[model samples]
Target chain A: MDAWFQNEVTYPHVAQEVLDAADSVRATLPNKYCDPEIAANLFAEAIDEYLLCDDLGINVICTEHHAGINSLLASNPMLLSILASQTKNVRILSLGTLITLRPDPVRVAEEYATADVLSRGRLEIGFVKSGLSEYASNQASPIDNGDRYWEAIDLISKALSHQEGVFSWEGKHFTHRHVNIWPRPYQPTLPRMWSATGDPSTAGDVGRRDMVQVLVLRGPEGTKTAFAANRRARAAAGMPKPTTDRFAYAALVAVGDTHEEGVRMGEKLMWFLNTSLRSAPQFGPKLPGLAPPQAAPGLYRTKPAAAKPGETASAAANAAALMNITAEQAMARGIMFAGSPDTVHKQIMDFHEAVGGFDHLSMIGRSGFMTHAETSKSMTLFGKEVLPRLKEVKTVTAGYNQPD
Target chain B: MTNATALPASGNLLIGDIELEVVRRGVGQPMLLLHGFQNIEPDAPFLDMLGDHASIIAPSHPGFGRSSRPKDVETVYDLVHCYLALLDSIPDEKVSLMGFSFGGWLAAEIAVKAGRRIDRLILVDALGIKISGPETPDIFDVFNKHPDEVRKRSWHDPAAQAPDYDALSDSQLANISRNWEALCRYGWHPYMYNPQLKRWLGHIKARTLVLWGASDGIVTPAYGEAYARLIPGARFETIDAAAHHPYLEQPRAFVDRVSRFLKS
Candidate 1:
């Protein structure tokens, strides 16, 4: 298993009363609340952490969100460039720069190529089918965003891999008359592609494309379901079944000297769900094309219904389940692993075993209010103690055990 | 051209590969009713009232009701072209084209292109042109604003006029969602207006009437007046105690006001 460390550089300094009063904590929140001095310190510390991960021999990840306290990384390529140029050894994955929101995917291709060259071919490209408040901030329509997402991926992939000079792309979502970048990617082929999705439909696409699939915060059941869909889709397509290496699970990971300390730190990570997910109706469930029209009964009716919201149904549904979740509950469901090194390891392996075994463990690191010192301490401990044991778990052919 | 009556019949119209859900009623000169943000509900009282005077042919735009929308049919331009094709299919010498809100935008576009095919044009709280300065938007952003605010802006008395979603059936809710999705796909960029439509409004050959809800916060009476001024010989009128959806809010007054214009 390969462990990747990630930090969202969350801003939790806003007054609780202000957060309570705002219709949305993201996109709609005024920029006046974001203190630049504090943001600078956050960037500095987060960069230091990335560098530390490089030294400790753990892979690093950079993700992007806009106009929100959840993350200051609005520009993934900017951070990708920083990590590409600064970090010495470890692989850097951009999980990534909301490609669907961008007006031009060719420009994204150029940015990725530059990062790849700077990193000496250590970059791994990842796509996120970004939605919700992101649509509002980016001024991109949420409707048909999926069509745009896949088209951007195709354009970026072709732009990177196609050696034959200037090519033209006329796609439904994007059209470029002349598509040529100055520098081709460092790797002969495009950096091993990754897509972050847990939905069965998107997971199937990931499987067919053979890209690594990362499921964030979805516990064993949801993860197992998505993996099964991936395997099933590949089999149906007459493609070889992907091994465990193609599947990855992301969760909050906080390792400490003692169990209580780790659990306490892990609880801090809950702020991501507890606060950052607060979005207005227009930017949340009401966003067009976020779900099928058939899902409208669940969304539009003011009266509560008896149907249990399946965890893997959609991100909005998943967000509802995650909000207000306790550290113990998160652990029991395999959404988190926090304890002494032995306990954290046991929790991870148990989760791995439960979800039919995945080779990549994306350890979503410190979140809101987790201080720089504490974050580094946990990372160092996790890197030094838990990672070696995880590495020993060999990649196996993936399979899904259906819940009876 | 007579097809108008008090009772309406629901059926499907096949236009090319697309099958459109349509309602036809009454027995008089042909009147093509272009619905607004939402498709005209079959039970909406104004439809039957309007049907009593003129034959009313109301088809839900692609992706709106039980309509089939091709993957490529996602823009207002596509809608205008589709409606133009529908006009060609009509047996009438000329059809009176009436549109509400988003449909008003479509009617204006169709009239601009349809030429002699459109005899009389009516826009009810229509949204198709820019009538304000760049910084000041003319239309309320229904998709971005708070739902309470949107509901309040949509009706003179939201408590009575606003839909109680809990009371609606699953299919009704699904239709609402489908309409919303289609609206967003067609109107999300440049925000429910065609930048060039204002410039072309003068070119419309059809005799025009622009109707508005006096209490419409979505698009004010002033914007409707400005819209009328842009179209040659177009007259502007407002219905009292009505908001964005005057037809649904005050069906009798809406029909009477429209009936007088059609006669004149």
Candidate 2:
């Protein structure tokens, strides 16, 4: 199993009273609260942590989130460039630029090519089907976002790999009259593409396209459902089965010398869920195209109506459900792997067993008030103790046990 | 056309493949009413009063109310063309066209293209043309602003005029959700206005009336005044103690203005 070290470089120093007063901590809150010096320091420390991960031989993932306290890495390629040039032994995954919000995918392709060249072919491109506050900040419409997502990916892929000179792409969402990038990606074809999504509706598309699909923070049941959807889609399309390496699971992880210390650090990660997720109604339940109109009863009512059986709940509701969750509950739900090295290893193996299997574990090691020293220590402990044991788990052929 | 989960069950018009929820009332003169941000409420008092003056044919825009919206029918250009087809379907008679808020943009576009089909036109708190420099936004962004700010700017008397969300039903909320999504799809970029529409406003052959809510902050009455100036011989008027939805806030006054204009 491949383990990835990820950090969102959150700014968690804001006063609790200020957070309480603001309707949302993202998009709307004035940037005066984000001290530039503190942000700079956070970035520097985060980069250092990535270097430590490189030394530890853990692959690094660069993520992007815009205008939010949740993540300071607003530009994935910027950080991916640093990781590509600075880190010697590790793989750098850009998981990734918010492509749906961007006007041009051709420029994105250029950036990926540059980064891949810098890394000497270690770059892995990932796309995020970003939504909610992203639409508000980036001036991108949530409606038809799906159309844009696929079209952007297609454009980017073609731009990166097309060796046959200038190509014109006039798709439904993107139009590049002259499409060509200099010094095409270092990889023989293109870097392995990955997509992070929680929606079952689009998981099928990811399966058909054969991009690595990462389910972030979805519990065992939700992850299993999405994975099954992917397999079912592949089977329906008469496609060959994949291996476990094609699937990835992302979760908050903390490792310490002792079990008690690790759980305590894991509690600090809850700030990401409790505070940073406090988006206004417009960006949450009221977000256009976030869910079908059938789910409005559960969205609009102060006391939401009980969800009907077989109905898919909105991602907003899922985020809302996690806001007040305790560390114990997080661990129980398989969203967090925390404790001493042995305990954490056991917890990971248990989650691996719960869901059929995933060969890539994307670990969010640093977030919300987690100090740099603590983050580094946790990374060291994870690298030294838990990683070797995890590597023993073999990647199995990917096929959902056909549900009777 | 693929059947959306939402069907225009209450729809009365079959414009080509598109089905629309329409409210028909009164007798005499044909008046095609285009709704604003959301579908016009069937029971709005202005409808009854406006009906007294002229025949009213109000069809909810596709993807609004219960109207089915095919994925292809998402742009303002599509709407303008659809309504033109609607006017053609009416046959020999020239119709008076009226639109509100987002619908006003659609109505204006259609009026420009369907010159001979539309005999007269009315735009109520309409949003279509860009009136100011790019940096200074002429219309308030409803999607980006706080909901409180949106309501406060939207109505002169928000306490009384705002829809009671808690009082609304599951279906009402669902309809609102659908309307919001569709509105975003049509208007999000270039943000509620067609950059080229201002130049084409002069092409409208219909005698036009531009109505506004005096306190409408979403798009100020000043913007409406500028909009009227772009069109040929269009009259501009404002209703007192009202904001964006003048028809909802002061229904009698709203109808009074429309009736007087239609008769003239």
Candidate 3:
């Protein structure tokens, strides 16, 4: 199965652990990770190990974390350069760098195109609107986010594909010079692009464009809802129904020799994420969105029961109550896949069947502050046991209608 | 409008001066199926899976099976352009496109260029992106040599591996070789398609679905996820036990997934 390694930190010691874990799972799995700098360093180590040891198909997932307040300042372009120089066969992906936050689409296009060339054309770029914190930190208004996103996408696309002259764009969010990027990507165009979205409307918008969408699994039913919405939007736009081949889903995974062991590990990880991580006194106050408590607890849960008009004091109160109820229900429903390899495999297969078909599956073994060893064991079990069982089922057909 | 039941039982459509034959069946919303490099027919296993829901159109790409070969069209881009023209010839204004294996690469190109006109696009075991993982077997190693070896390379379970390749006839080998050469001609570059295809993917305005055979040997599942992440509003599903041809290996699950997607 295709497995992605989530790089939560950039420490060298941690990087080595992740690399070692990746090596163990490499026999039965494909490994992917985020963070450009860490990826660059880890990739170098991985290549050496791979050459000396057995070859493992490990990939790096790079993200333009425009969500961070100091992202632009913190981002290291040199890391990408290092990655390009260090690795030969691994694919490098810009999981996405926010398009809306940057005013110059040409610059964004040029940077990614350069990266693609540096990586020998293995780059994939994902576009997203900077998170709320990014806008707040940059002192930008949220009203213009969507407009900027579309504009940036247009400018970047034109600059990458149309080779002849400088392409000028006049949009509400950005106006750019008539300058085309040099040294276009190795492919006829730049690396393939995908837009990441959380909302149905956004998913629909991406669907209508026939672009790739990465739907993060917030809850058990979230993928189904998003997939259905996208299909409907595409159909309503008078576009042909999406083929079943274009769907992808992400999940949190923990596998063990026995169901009890898996549950204990998953629970420990969740507890650490929820309680142990130290928070700066000013962190919650400074960034309201970052503080999970500030938002309704159940906001990410399944379809909440609609509030009866006038039943609650305000929408916030009603949402809070609904969320609590939904979380309880989800817990009872056993939505989270935590069990033995056989049980986990069955759960995943059932989930795939329930949501129709998904082309890609991403699992995050490290949740909150789980250790590298914990994550490694989980990944190993997944690669060895869960993946084998998943390969037993039939291939999903190409559905011509939108998903509901 | 002609209903699905009323459609003629004609053979596949032979298009282009090259006489590229495409099998067309059923009616209603148009659905096109593009096969990969294996030279397998869009047999009952595949057609029956998708036939009942919409008008099914399965084409045997040039240089594969019985389809007429195009002397000049060498690269994947040429194949993509040809397919775009084929869609324009169809009576329907827009049709859903599904590409398997190499066909998936062509489908991505078509979706990017045609955008909204193509409607929905599905890519299964697609080979466009240059992924960093286990080196995919060269076409010669897969299509020209022992077919069972190709299957074993991908199939995780010993039971699922195909039988001895020595028993295969000469024609099967010829078809395999021809298709492999075609694939190589189109996908020789380390990163199969334009690196910028990822960036251009955002421009496509059609709903997309990336379907994969979980045990696909040619492309890793990580590559599949990369495709999903690259396409906006795209969804990904992995079918079990299946290798490159999920439609052939896991027809029921494949049909169920497609049926649900179409209905939704």
Candidate 4:
């Protein structure tokens, strides 16, 4: 099976745990954790184990959180420079720096370009809107959030691709002076750009921009809306439709000899996420400009009555009483995919067909609360049993050109 | 237009210019506290912490708190320049700078320009460094999700529970929205700061302290350390049992750390 491992690295304390957990998996599977420098040594050790696998790659999605955990690491640009020197053959995907949140798109173009060049064109970028909490905590008004997000994207793209010395933009939210990004990206016309979103509008917007769409498989139904929106938007934007083969679908996956054991382990992790870890407060109070649902009472649940027809059936049900959805709905929707190899294979096929086929299937073998041993077991099971089945299924082609 | 008045009892130099109202307090060892993306008060723990040792100047950056929205000041750098002018108005030859969230980023910019005039700098849960990894969710996204889910994502400390939105007064919500708009004006840029700011840290000669809540879900600790390392000789610390605004959650610990840092 073609396997892609996806994980998040936060600050040092948490990142170390994530790296260690990832290491446990490397002992058994071809895996990599998109991590930062504070966890570099641990990541290096994980790589040592990972390299044992015949075909493997490491993707370091570097960011400021690494610096936030320790004072010695340089800021983003310097950190990217450091990342360039740290490893080889590992694809460096900048999940994305919020280009829209920046005042100078030219600078973003220049920096990411430098990063791509430094990493020998290993850079893959993803852009997103700065979270509302980030804006609020930083004292940015919600009104400017959307405008800034798009503006930054526009400027960055222009600066990265433009052959001329100057580019200009005049928007209601931001104005520029002699816009030009120095030191263009290593890849021709900038490395591939991706946009991450959990919302349909956002997914569609990314497709409209002709960028890759990174969809988090929160649940089966939500995934459907994301796929549908993306497809529709891509078609409308006159961009080539993203086949399941071009997209990456990520979900929390755990494999075991028996379906019950994996489910038990996965559920335990979910309980931790849904309980102990879920107590942190929202950054700021809601704002008027936000959509009604976003500003409404229940968090993360779409209101059932408002659910669009053809949206996930589970999402519609959850929306109706989102604050009160049972664990069964969450499980059946594939929010947390757990099973034996046979079960997992079936689920993968279903998901692949559901999304019209994904180029890569990334499993988050570790999360905020999962321990190393548990993740390792899941990784081992996946590598030995589930992967073979995935490899055998040749109904669809691989997404990107596989590394030689 | 609100009137400009200085408060002798609080030692606050108050400047109310139609669109903005600024409050400056304390004395001896001048320092500036740039408020976050929200309305703040004199009683905020960080302000209270530094009040004892320095001439603490806390301004409601235009379009926040009691500050009116000034048409003239648009970008975050504009606010930075305005604050620089405020420091120039003071009698002290130099000043220490501290900012929280958006203010922290502004302080960095001001310090870069003020150079030798800034003796020390502290940024608490500051924003405006660009790192590429897991996307930091926006406040709106958090609120849309379960409050508990948002909290878990942000706070390292279990004690930092989500705020009871139902309990907040209308005025509080209104103030938050008003300030959020102002924040968008300055922070809408992706990566939050000029990418050049990373390299510019070499220009800032002041001793710096970068502090964050161990559990902060907003900017994440990784972003915090990035800021600290960018500045020469900057130190980093995490406040236990705190989220994005440690000074608000663990006032005593927050103050104690600042007191020790400033003293050193």
Q: What is the C-alpha lDDT of each candidate?
A: 0.89, 0.87, 0.58, 0.60
| Residue B167, model 4: Cα distance from true site in angstroms | 12
lDDT of 3 by residue, A308-368 (tens): 4312112222222322222223323334566788878776766667766665555545544
Model 3: residues with Cα > 4 Å off, grouped in runs: A10-60, A64-91, A268-336, A388-404, B1-264
Ranking by TM-score: 1, 2, 4, 3
Model 1 Cα lDDT, one tens digit per residue, B210-253: 99999999999999999999999999999999999999999999
Give per-residue lDDT, candidate 3, residue B202.
Answer: 71
Top candidate on lDDT is 1
TM-score per candidate: 0.96, 0.95, 0.45, 0.50
Q: Per-residue alpha-carbon lDDT of model 4 for B1-264, expressed as tens digits?
A: 223332233433334453345555555787888877565665555565557878776767777765765665668767776676666666667688989877888888888999999988999988766655446433323333445554676555545444554565555555555565566556655435665676787788889999999878777787788778778899999998888778777878988988798889
Candidate 3 chain A minimal-lDDT segment of 10 residues: A278-287
Report residue A205 deviation for candidate 2 (angstroms).
1.7
Scored against the true structure, residue B128 in model 4 reaches a CA lDDT of 64
Model 1 C-alpha lDDT per residue in residues A1-404, reported as the tens digit of each score = 99999999899989999999999999989999999999999999999999999998889999999999988999999999999999989989999989999999999999999999999999999999988888888889988888898999999999999998999999998999899897999998779989999888999999999999999998888888888888889999999868889999999999889999999999988898899888887777867777688888988865222324434657777777788888889998789999999999999999998888898999888799888898899999999999999889988888744441
Sort the candidates on lDDT, descending order: 1, 2, 4, 3
Tens digit per residue, CA lDDT, model 2, B4-73: 3321324467766788888887766878899988898878888888888777888888899988787688
Give the Å shift of residue B259 in candidate 1: 1.0
lDDT of 2: 0.87
Worst 10 residues of 4 chain B by lDDT: B1-10
